[model samples]
Target: MKQKKPNILFIMTDQLRGDCLGIAGHPDVKTPYLDTLAAKGVLFSNAYSACPSCIPARAALHTGMLPEHHRRVGYQDGIAWRYEHTLAGELSRAGYYTQCVGKMHVHPLRNYLGFHNVELHDGYLHYARYGSVPYRESQHVADDYYYWLKEQKGISADPMESGLDCNSWVARPFPYEEKYHPTNWVTDRSIDFLRRRDPDQPFFLMASYLRPHPPFDAPAYYFDLYKDKKLTPPYVGDWEDTKLLKERGRIFDSLTGPEDEELIRQAQIGYYACITHLDHQIGRLLMALTEHELQNDTMIFFTADHGEELCDHHHFRKSLPYQGSIHIPLIISGNPELTGFAPHSVCDEVTELCDIMPTLLDIAGADIPDRVDGKSLLAFADGEGREYLHGEHSYGELSNHYIVTKKDKFCWFSTSGTEHYFVLEEDPHELHDRIEDPACRERIAYLRNCLIRELTGRPEGFTDGTSLIAGREYPVYLAEK
Candidate 1:
């Protein structure tokens, strides 16, 4: 380490899949830089976002609390981030100079959350485009990247000129030069921070990228790299009725993917292209760290708020209890002496976004506050952590709860009595639903009871402390919160 306290370089991507990295043996996507980072540090292979969406998952990251405590169970905009203590806040109190240079996704578009300073750039929010929202508070106005884009192009230039839906399965090449892309801009601002940072105090810099999330606009070069190739096929559970696929994917922004194989392939091509683009941009950031001679001293951590379904199991977006939506890539690369684990280690611990704050706080030797409900991975390196993870999302009819372990998974829809079970070790793609299998009877019942226990005494009334309930109304946020 360079000083008594190591500088922190925390990088986050929006809606990136856990299996998108080359290091993870992904057959289609190319992420050389992330692979290298994972090889150099401990990779939490089972890392997840308990509430797999932007807003709720981020609440876990900022506060080290689960969805129940954070009160953000799903995607909802314009709600206040009412937490007093935050990862950045506590780190700032620990004498680290904190700076966030990308998406915060908190209310008001400019809520610092505890960072000493922030360079805001939350991507196309439907709430901000409304005429009722004030100009000063709107995303276009508050976003530094938007202002920079206008300066580079004409004042009238917009990222939305491509005419792509933000959450659509549609694919397209980026019209603008790579220099003007949001991913590159995030790295540019991050590199700028390294130069402008105070030399004396240790720093915490979060380079948050908003790519691989949507508009499917990778630069033409990245897009072209995979356009002609045959990519891995998107998965569909055996229980799904194939005849209704077209109906499920009829709309532009359908949650379930298209029936056409070519369109599904195009979506994969575009999504993988974005991952390679983000990976190369990350290479630039890594070079900057080395150029500044900070590579050895700075503790570099990388993760995403949530994973993209990318047409997996016929789903196209997040906020579902599926592996593609909740499984996130988590890597912490630094001095092994400080991290208490061997380099290039892979952990199977069921870690979550909630664990990030405590891990970072523990790394800085700061106090882990009582409000934190997460355990440190540095401690988990010694073979400790929960045996399984409990995840959920409040997506109306699709609102559900699940329990995932290294061996298997069990999911139950809240509003409906529907259930699904997967023996992940034997069927990693979840091609076979084992919910009704006599072989999986005992395991499913155990996991169902686990979910019931987890949901006991909740405002949603998902359980009665003994049995799992169906047809319960699930709210995006707890009423008490």
Candidate 2:
């Protein structure tokens, strides 16, 4: 008999930094299980989120399209997702049963898009929480995780009882039992899906977790693991304006600002705790897969929507053009019996979340859509990848654009017309900006012209004939699409 096609397990996390894993050489964060998986497969060391925010990043992932193509250039809530082709939809058409266990972040709260079934758990979204239009249905209906939490704990049980803002830098241990945490709940439902899935047909399961993103509420043991360890301080760039420290310091959810040392450490502890907790749950999922004798027939892909700044360059969140905000981890592993499987390898190609859909479809022997902007990473595992990646986000007054290659990066601030360049080979942490270096002036001009070409025809009119115009309010979503 012909061999059955391999199962696909696409694991995703929210706001997880690229370098926080032990395999990525993180000094303090411990991700032993993820490291082991990386050792057994191919790890894309230079993966990035083009838009570096929740909504746009996920748009790129689902549609295999660029931010510009998808028309979600920045963070916008309550917009209807009207895409015709999606990763799950295409896979379902290819004879696979696709199911999403965690966050989908699709509008309408129940927009399954292409997934046969989606048990959503989108963490604290202001648009849905405030009973905004188009999301009023969400306000009336609780997510699967929230309803389950109410059943496990009382109706008043909340993850915020620990006194931490969902998106703020505050930190604390979870107020309830470890199993009652959302991370474990996500894993629990995922395992239950595995136990109850249709066994005759191959399955495509997306185990998406929403932790290490906010509330920073890991259980006590996980939090205690990092509370007393000497931690690395956030990098402070020489060109960063310290004035931002004072200007936005007191704002609870300000994107960029200086935070006290103790508070930063506490936040780091909580963040790392959440990662470890998530890692442990991932271990459980892997064990369950093995217990079901599905390990050798399953292809697993692990990644995140984007990275967190975590006070890097005095920035506390994503949506910046820095490595801390855009860079993310991508690891793909599967049975050695699988075709094109590269064991114990690291691919240093420039990859993005957009590549996910095509890559998975490629593995499943399905046809890739003609309109996708992303190429299949499976074909580039041992070969060259994109020459450079363009990333941008509309951050109200701080809208920005960036172009990044393997060795360097160029950033442009649309509000102030300021330029910043960094040589990644010499300064991977982006401690120094070299835009003023005479030796690099020509390269800077080249990158600036590239950025101009990218934005020249956009609806915002961010670029004129030759130069980028400043002070224009960039729209969250393009109107002319």
Candidate 3:
């Protein structure tokens, strides 16, 4: 007799910060269910999204490759994805029923890529929603969630009734029933999938949530949890020049200048509320798994595509190299009876979003391709991993590259050749920059060389033979063949 393969529940949230969980010691954000899940499994404190945006970060995630290999270095929309080996494709090949429940965000909008079926709900993509194309023939195809909302709340129902921009820093309570919210709708459809799935074969279900990402529209009850509390203010680095950053002009999807303290507080309240609401939905999903007697044989993983800035360093969105914009939460939990299982443990190894592919394949007894740039974290307890992780993104005027190790972080702005360094052990909030300190000059030079080497031979001409060049045009996609 052979052992039964375990089912996999891959849960992903969008733009959720790594430190927003109660287990991560967030000052006000309460995620009791996630805290319980972390206690029952392994938590990676240093996990990050290399590109720190929806398209590129998800490219790294599904392909198990870095931005350079995946060729999505920035927040690009409508480029066709042509990866040969994807997480869902490999799992489907290995006899698992792979399905995705939200936010595929792929070109053509309905492209399934590898998942056998995708119930997508990509919230408010401006390019797709308001492009020059016609409504019926363009990417404006109605998503499952939107249709469901109309069925439940009538055709005039709109998530924008709260009067908040989807990607802005403004915050407000959702203007509809809690059950009608997109977050709950995602979980609802996910539970429906589990109830209707084939019982004999092991499954790989991706419950992807798009909340906590923007519009900041959580339910009023969830918002009330933090409305009266004194939330922690965003970190202000000593080297940050707000005036200069504002002078760069307001880019799309970002707020310019310093926001008022009250507005910032409301934003934090709404952001945290969204997280908590999503956490509650997670609790419901876990309950459904147990109700179906699948909890004991399911391996659950929770993470996000990237993190939100929430006014950190005077920034409001992603595409920056700051910790608030790149760092993400990764929790792996499930049956302790499984192989190589460890309970209530935390792994601080530097991990990236790409690592998720190999990790899942390793658990499912599938073959990982040689082209993968990410390593399986299944053996994380043995202390075998990279010494440092490299990350970069094209942020228009703020294009930058970075290398993060356990002890420190180094950042380089390609537009101006400006460098910033932080000793992680001493300054966790990154309020101080050590680039100019005489004692740290050698380390800075070493990290700079490492970054330069990583950027060498790219199509953007970001680097020469000896050093990184300044003022290169930001590369959003790979040069045509």
Candidate 4:
């Protein structure tokens, strides 16, 4: 008799920091269900999103390639996702029933990227919500969540009633009931998929959530969970440059935090509440899996597109070189025998979103495509990993490239050629700059040379093969071939 192929549940969240999980020793946030899941399986302490923004990060996950290979080194919306092979496409071809329950932030807004089906709710994308866009592509017309919300309440219902911008740090409790919240709606639709899935074939279900991203309108119950608690001060780095970093850092008013302490408090409360609410909804999925007797046969992986700065050093959003923007939580829990690790074990190997597709492909007994640049993460259990990983984003004046090893990180700005180095093992919060430290001088030079080599021959004119060039035109998208 043949063994059954395992069902994979890839649970992804938006803008959730790596340190936000209780299993990761987050001092304030409460994620009881995720903590229990991490305790039962493997936790990747150093997992990252190489291109730490929405489009590029998701490209890496779907294509199993690095940002350069995917030709989307930054967050540029509407560019065609032209990858010939994708995770969902490969899995569906491998005789599995692949279904994406929520949030496929692809170009064309409805591009399947190879999934057999997609039930999407991208959560208030500005590109789709624009007044000039075609009505067929508008959020209200295309977003299932928006359409459903209007059905539940009336044509006049809107998520914007709470008065928050999608990219702003402002936060508020959802005016509607918890059942009507997008977080619960995503889980609701996901559970419905499980009930209707084809039992004859194994499945690949992406349970993607848009909370912990922005407009932090979690239900009031969740907001109350953290609103009264003492706000933990965000990490403030001594090297923060208030003058030039507003383009890269400040998501709020100041480079340290917002001028309005009440607003900052609300942002923190709302952000943490979104995460806790996501955790509980995941618990509901776990319960559903067990009730269906599919718990043992299912493999689960949890992670995020990128980490929210959450006012770290006054940086409120992502696309920065800081840990608060790049580092993300990664927890894989299911069957110990299939995952190849002892329960409660943690792996510190430098991993990134690119590794996800190949890892899942390897686990599912599918053939990984030749375009994949990432290695299977299961190799980490056997003590296999690269010495370092390269990450970058093209943000014009503040555009930056970085090299992060397990122990440290080095960043270089494209416009000014300014360099910064940090010994991550010694300074986890990145509170101090070690660039001037004589002992780190040699290491910094080596890392800079590594960056120069990584950028060599790129059309962006970032490097001339021998050294980096400043004032070069940094492009957010690849040139037409």
- Local distance difference test values of all predictions, in order: 0.89, 0.87, 0.86, 0.86
Clashes of 3: 0
Distance from true location, Cα of 65 in model 2, Å: 0.4
Give the range of the ten consecutive residues with the poorest summed lDDT in model 3.
Answer: 248-257
Better of 1 and 4 by lDDT: 1
How high is each candidate's TM-score? Answer: 0.98, 0.97, 0.96, 0.96
In angstroms, give how far residue 297 of model 3 lies from its true place. Answer: 0.4
- Residues 1-481, model 4: lDDT tens digits: 2337899999999999999998898888999999988998999999988888898999999999998888888888878787789999999988889988778888878889999988889987888877577777777777888878999988553588878877777778888889998889989999998899878789999999998888888888898899889978888789876554445334543223454568778889989999999999999988999887788889999999999888787767788888999999998898888778888999999999999999999889989999899989888889898889999988766689899999999998888888889999999999998888899999998999999899887888888887889898877887745
List residue ranges in candidate 4 displaced over 4 A: 1-3, 244-257
Clashing pairs in 3: none
True-vs-predicted CA distance for residue 382, candidate 1, Å? 0.4
Q: How far is 360's C-alpha from truth in model 3 (Å)?
A: 0.5
lDDT score for candidate 1 against the true structure: 0.89
Off by over 4 Å in 1: 242-244
lDDT of 1 by residue, 1-481 (tens): 2479999999999999898888887888888899899889988899999999999999999999999999998889888888968999999999999999989999878889999999988888888777788888887788898989999997553588888888888889888888999999999999999999888899999999988998799999998889988788987777866543567877778878777778888889889999999999999999999999899889999999999888777788899888899889999999999888788999988999999999999999999999898999998988888988899999988888899998899999989879999998898778999899998899999999989889888987788888888998887888754
Winner by TM-score? 1
Model 2 residue-pair collision total: 0
At residue 105, what lDDT does model 2 achieve? 85
TM-score quality measure for candidate 2: 0.97
lDDT of model 2, residue 435: 97
Local distance difference test, candidate 2:
0.87
Give the range of the ten consecutive residues with the poorest summed lDDT in model 4: 248-257
